[model samples]
Target chain A: MCDSCGCNITPGNRHLVAEGEPGHQAIDVLQHLLSANDHAAAHNREHFDRHGVLAYNLMSSPGAGKTALLEATLQALAGEFRIAVIEGDLETENDAERIRRHGVPAIQISTGSACHLDAHMVHHALHDLDLDAIDLLFIENVGNLVCPASFDLGQHRNLTLLSVPEGDDKPAKYPVMFRAADAVVFTKTDLLPVFDDFSIERATRYLRELASAAPVLNASVRSAQGLAAWLDWLRDDMRALRARIAGGEAVRPAVQPDGAALHAAESAA
Target chain B: MHELSVCQALVEQVVRVAREHGAGSVARVTIGVGALSGTEPALLRQAYPIACAGTPAEGSTLEINERPIRVRCALCGAETDARANRLLCGACGDWHTQLLSGDELLLEQVELAKLAEAI
Candidate 1:
């Protein structure tokens, strides 16, 4: 019996010590808690690449018109390219059902008590879709500005929408979310006339203050011109992604560095 | 809050590490939470107990090492601290700065509880 801490060391245990102070073993485990999610996200990304699909993660606060934008997009590019959706929400299948009504395959991920969708949830959603038939997939994330930005959903591009009603100060307040955006959209611009408090200039300046060069585009569900600009951006982005993929490269959205920044030794670089 | 979920992941990771080291229990779990991590440390501390309940890490202490937001300038190559909202190079005041750190949620270390004696 080992007299120090008493029990049976037996001289063979891996925690064996010849003659030293009995203490807790502190292991240097420099790992990210989000590694599992990042791995699952990488798997999903590879799956998307295999099927030549370009995925976009649409993020915003509640009532930011993510689904409305998708509906308009579906209407605009119905026959041109095959499209699908993965709608994530705390509850209800309303968004998925809405997308389904457009004759497109839409999968719903009901996270229940969870605030945001993780890669595993999106992985399950991908199982239901025919990726080969889809050229573009939009993962409309749960309506929260904070949590979703920290999670990666295996998308080629991350698009965050800030409605005019949400005010221009959002970018300054939610820096993490704004910084994760590859592109930001000013949604519900048609309401800007009534919501005179919202300023495009101020909002843009706030976004630029974060040192983010993410292109801000104007979009309103009511106007054709607004939708046209968004559709053009989408088409151009898809073309860029396709070109990259053709050149044996894949587009990587600027994921929140909480996990990726650690695993890839991005800090060391 | 999402910190609860993040804590869940943290517990999962700690338990896994504990098992890897043949640890029956854990005494402490240390992590680095960055200013720009989008996770609130207070919320994580609140969620820790719930996440550690019934796990090997139950009753363990969660030591949070808060990392400050830092950016490196392309012009001057100086790494300095910056505010969460403002990511400009603190030294050169350059807007063309890249994030050097501060978004990390790293599980830095873990202290395993009384090993062979406890067993």
Candidate 2:
């Protein structure tokens, strides 16, 4: 029997069944799966513009303290910035609930078995939020460091987080996320004294070498250490985003070709 | 993990392409999985069938070509295939080499058979 169609066939049959056809054929496809996500991301950017929201896509590993950073960020900036959050997870709404505790409007996107959040998911999440009331929108993408880097959530800035416990070699291990990031935040600095493996110097050097002049901030939400600098950078970024939008600039920065060296290095294994 | 997400996107694209080309079923879909793109081709293949369910590409075959990492050596000014485990130059053993290829996830082509032509 043919496994694909469950049709009985003799062993001497000349035609062997294939998954898609009777025989295998190679097609020279040169398209990117992210192309669909990219198109939807562009539309998402336009939608954000119409509502006057500055979105920031946050990327990090599972235990990198992304939600904690958001909680602290909302508490500190809430008086000034009308912050909202869209949390992506494979299962729970725990992160979204945590952000909501800060009194900011928050939405949780459960991607089911998928590991990353695409632009279409963000578009759907946006429809549920009151865009007019949102000033600074934060999207905490799924925890994996790899896939989220390939997706753009229509954010004005992309922030990648790495906790101290994750080690200084993260920039070397996950270069593409670091390269695409507008700013890299080193979280869980409060644990630095406890772990000898954490080296700020090594992390800084590697990040500078990979990102070439991108900003790196070490922060700990528990102690509020370095949180001020983080908030200040966000303020500056949001201000600039506002200026650009007001100037009628496009929602996103200029699109560089995917073949750029920086992108290649970061996305490279 | 991420392969599952990529697989889902792949199925959606194959369906769209098949419909546009007026094909009843997809014959083949070619995708380039760059060596440095952080995608595991084996994992993508394992997840492809599950992600393709209920789509036009349900039984379609996913052809993934493994792309080698290409890098430009900083010391020798030469471009060569890079070793995935180490970013060092293939010829000079320089760690400061700049990467050139193997970070792309490109969909190269799609083959579909016309409904009337299918045996």
lDDT of 1 by residue, B12-117 (tens): 9999988888888888787888978899999999999999999999999887888878888888999888888888878777677788778888898788875654
Q: Which pairs of residues have clashing backbones in candidate 1?
A: none
DockQ of each: 0.49, 0.37
True contacts kept of 1: 0.75
Per-residue lDDT tens digits for candidate 1, residues A28-63, read 788887888877887798899999999999999999
Q: Please give the TM-score that candidate 1 achieves against the real structure.
A: 0.91
Error of 1 at B14 (Å): 1.0
Summing lDDT over every window of 10 consecutive residues in candidate 1 chain A, give the lowest-scoring window: A10-19
- lDDT scores of the candidates, listed in order: 0.86, 0.76
Per-candidate TM-score, chain A: 0.88, 0.82
TM of chain B, each:
0.92, 0.88
TM-score versus the correct structure, for each prediction? 0.91, 0.79
lDDT of 2 by residue, A208-233 (tens): 54523468898999889999999898
Output DockQ, candidate 2: 0.37
